[model samples]
Target: MTSSNTTDTATARREDPPTTAKKKRSRELIIAQLIGQVALLLAIPVLTRLLSPAEMGIYQTGLSVALILQPLATLRRELLIPFAGVRDARKHRWIGLGFAATLSGAIALVALPAWALGNATLAETLLATALILPSFALMYVENAFLIRHSAQGRLAVRNLVGGVLSAGLQVVAALILPGAIAIAAALLLGRAAATFVTVARRTPSSDVESPGEKKSQRSISAILSAMIAAASSQAVVIVSFASLGPSAAAQVAVGQRVAGAPASLIGQALTQIALSSAAPLIREQRPGMTSQLRSLTIRTGAAAAVTAAALMIGGPLLAVPILGPGWEVAGVMTAVFAVPLSLTLVALPATTLLIPLGRERLLVSLQTVRLVAIVAAIVVSSALTQDVFTTSIVTAAVWTLAYVPLMTAAFTATVAHDRLCAQVVNQSSAP
Candidate 1:
């Protein structure tokens, strides 16, 4: 009787939700991500108080440009994280770092024309940004490493420190000197600090190249797809700047930053967390993990809905007063953009499959669609209405509308692929 009772107790314990699920790593990453994003959210109000709307616009424009460049410079390095485990891409981590350094140098040389052309200030900022690009790649590697190792405590602490340092410095910079370059400089300093603590600690010998088979974490199709998708994402902002002009461009950038906090924070964090958490489940032939990811995605979307409602109702009220009366439009735009940003929770989680499943081809295809929709909306709206907020709203709407179907397709594909793989493994091992 006691043995039967013990079996029953064991089964009950196994079935219990709390016992069955901890999501400890996910929780750590979320906390870390929350700190970083919250800092940015808080920074927006304070920054607007210190900098004029035009200055704010200039800062975001420069940032948007740098954001695109950063990825382009380290495209391969970013790909190196997952491929780090792949035998074919051996020694690629080191080679990729070398390539990043070379690209940054080439970028600086390319930016030199700005000085000759009499855009000295823009030139200087871009130059600083160029130097900062390598740090961004290294920072990404550092974060991915923590996830790879399941070093949750280290990751959480690093994020907290990075976020606080970033926020504190931005506040100081805005108060002391209000300009686009000052903001950019402060941003660079924050990233540099994070990179120093995170990546700089790895020994040079650790990155030594391996010469062997040309195996890869992903196929050529996957790599090309990731590259194109990444480039398009960067291209969107550049295209926005060209199409909408600086102030309008700033409105889009700032609105997304403030309004899309749920997606940027929760959505992005979950995606990053999924890299560490879900990749193994898929590799180990675990049953039902994809379903779990889908369920989690839905829960996150519900929470994001709540966050969007709060931002939409409360954002403008707090924003207008805090950011000063002149920048009221930016705040209003932020509120307007919140709804679409809420839906991004689904899209973001869906993106996780691209890395683990080598669905880079699918990602490129989907993002190509998203990119075209975003740019078309910006271009068409800016041309017709000549209003930044209108263009921004239209663009956000398009992103939301397009991404729902995209995410659904990706999620469906991911589930089907995993299930098929599971069946294959079961069949092969049976013999």
Candidate 2:
């Protein structure tokens, strides 16, 4: 009787709703993501002014390439951060630190060849990458752990500190160095400093024991599985951009960024809050989760629509003076892209359903298909029309429209499966 009572108590504790403390954490997480995004948006104009298009093109391309390598090095250990509902902080800290260290080493190893490449542009890119790649990769686990632990406020602060400091450094460097490579290199260094400070201060310094006394806590198979899932999911949009020429890709990327900026800023903070609170919500099958998701979708869609309308009509007029003459197209792209991007609010939270359901492998499969389609569309479009802009616009529109539906469907399927399993368990327990 006592053992059964203890089990019930443990289950109840895990199934509790978002407490006042957890709500506060969520707010903090959302705020951090927004602050960082805003910093990125603000820094763009200054950075653009300091560097030429060609240099910007090289830097952007290098970033795209680096992103492909990022998931590989991290091997998806960061995803474990948000999965902390099942584990205690002590365990999370050790594994998280181990993951970060291992990922950093892997990134450095991968970056060496690019840094050694003889081409000046490649050399500059490799140098910039050497400074920034490890920092970006390292932050993943910290960010995830913070979200998992319901430390949203701390996470936000970390992101806020990193973004603001990095942006400030980039601006300062641009003013002093005033060149593409110099500015890029400076930006990398700034980001590194910010990320280092945040993780080092927040994460506990310790190692967890592996079952087999292996150097790493998680097995290679588990790590690789997670990495593959994340990599496949991240590949679609990023790889699509890479296949397109830098300038053309940059234009759409700019529009996508603008469209996503507001929501992303808002949602990121919410994401932290949501993830921290969501574990129990899922465990109890709380109605509030669905309600919150619905609310988010409506809010995001409405805001995106308004922003899109404004950009579409006022875009050309406002853009000409600010971005230069030929750049008016950016405004149009922004308008076209914003509405679709806004749907991310709905898609992102719904997608979280997969995490709690342990349907990560399925999610990865869906994303793999999405990426393949994106690449195929770009390739076919490019072959049909030699113009990069045309190909980009077509590809962007397709992706933007499809994002919400795909995620929504995926979540729905997951929810259905969970319900069926729960029903079976209830029947089995019936006396």
Candidate 3:
């Protein structure tokens, strides 16, 4: 009986790692998502009370500009994905990225003084944004490593640490400093700290490559496509600010953050897992994977929409109570922005299809069209309605209606083409 018991214990221990990895990763992602949403919720009351609505507006607006530039500065880190599993490509990619980050940071720093001397607009904010480039670039590079390794635990840690530290610093900085400067400084510090944390805990960059995987080399065309895709991530915010001024842009930005938390939570978790799974599916030309991908896309999209709808009802109710009286305008727009967010969740799975299919040019083209539409809608709506909320309504409608069909069809077609080509190649190569 003693020998049998010992054998059983040994067997259980041996079986645990393989059996539990997926479950463990899923739990980590869920925890990370909850932390993010809860942190955002906790942050609203403190930030809004300490900083005026106008200050919040200005901070978010300037930060949006920084966000649009981030992808461009990094040469679009997503372009590094295919090579995530390859050694030579990963090494060269890192060296290139390091050089790019250094050059970009230096240029931005130099431009700061030049802008200040020239008395250019938003020089201070741009300067702060520029200072963050190196750390921010490192964050993206590490993200590729984590995804490649399926290091979901580290990814979760990265998100939780970066976000909480950043938000905490914003609170502390607000107490210690004045105006948007505190928030801007907090943003930079948070990014820098998060990058350090990710790097410190990460498996060495060299470990990201597997000897058996196909090597993917970076191309200028691929990099360009990635840059466009990354830049489009925040085009709406840029357009909103340009068309509606700081206050209106502020309200929309806040609404998107507040009202869209549920969808963001869902989207974020799905994205981490989806990217991990999708990369191999496309790279190997596995037709079997698309059915599963399609199923997941539908389920997640529906879940996001339903969750956003429920929050829409509750979000408006809580906005004033949580954010104080100044954000009542954001309250009204919060649910409004969330509608588009739920709709936008479709793009997550749709986008995962692009990397494996090697169809980034298509992705870029589609994103460009959507960016154009967003800008056009904002411009036309601002002219017609002359109100921020009204323009947002039009923009949300356009984004949802315009984006879903094109994105879904793009994924479907890309998957089908890759599968067909794989079949043809298999037959040709068959002995």
Q: Rate the local accuracy (lDDT) of all candidates.
A: 0.65, 0.57, 0.65
Model 2 agreement with the true structure over 1-431: per-residue lDDT tens digits: 99999999998887776465555655666667678878877876666666665555556555544555555555555545554333443355565556555654554466567566745555555545444555556566567765554455566777787777777887887788765456556656666666556553333422332221112223344344334433433333355445644455445545555656666566555555556555545544433455555566576567667766665666556655655545555666666555556666656656645545556655665655665665676678878997656765666666665575456764575556556657766887899
Could you say which candidate leads in TM-score? Answer: 1
- In model 1, which runs have C-alpha deviations exceeding 4 angstroms? 1-3, 10-22, 86-92, 198-215, 218-248, 428-431
The Cα error of candidate 2 at residue 292, in Å, is 4.4
Q: Candidate 1, residues 78-129: lDDT per residue as tens digits?
A: 4445435443233555555566678777767876898899976556546655
Cα lDDT, model 1, residue 167: 73
- RMSD values for the candidates in order, in angstroms, are 4.3, 7.4, 5.0
Q: What is the lDDT of candidate 3?
A: 0.65
Output candidate 1 Cα RMSD.
Answer: 4.3
Candidate 3 weakest ten by summed lDDT: 211-220
Worst 10 residues of 1 by lDDT: 206-215
Residue 218 displacement (Å), model 3: 5.7
Taking the tens digit of each residue's C-alpha lDDT, what string does model 3 give over 1-431? Answer: 99999999999989998658876786787688667556745776788788766666666666665555555666555446544555543574476567656665665576567675884435544555554455456556666666766667777887777767777877888888746656766766886777566653435754554543546533444455545544444555556666656566666678777765665555656666666665665555555556656777687778777877876787788878888876777777777767767755667656645654556666666767776787788779988998777877887777677566556755676668657957967898899
Query: After TM-score superposition, what is the CA distance of residue 193 in candidate 1 from its true location, in Å?
Result: 2.8
Ranking by TM-score: 1, 3, 2
* Candidate that beats the other on TM-score, 1 or 3, i.e. the better one: 1
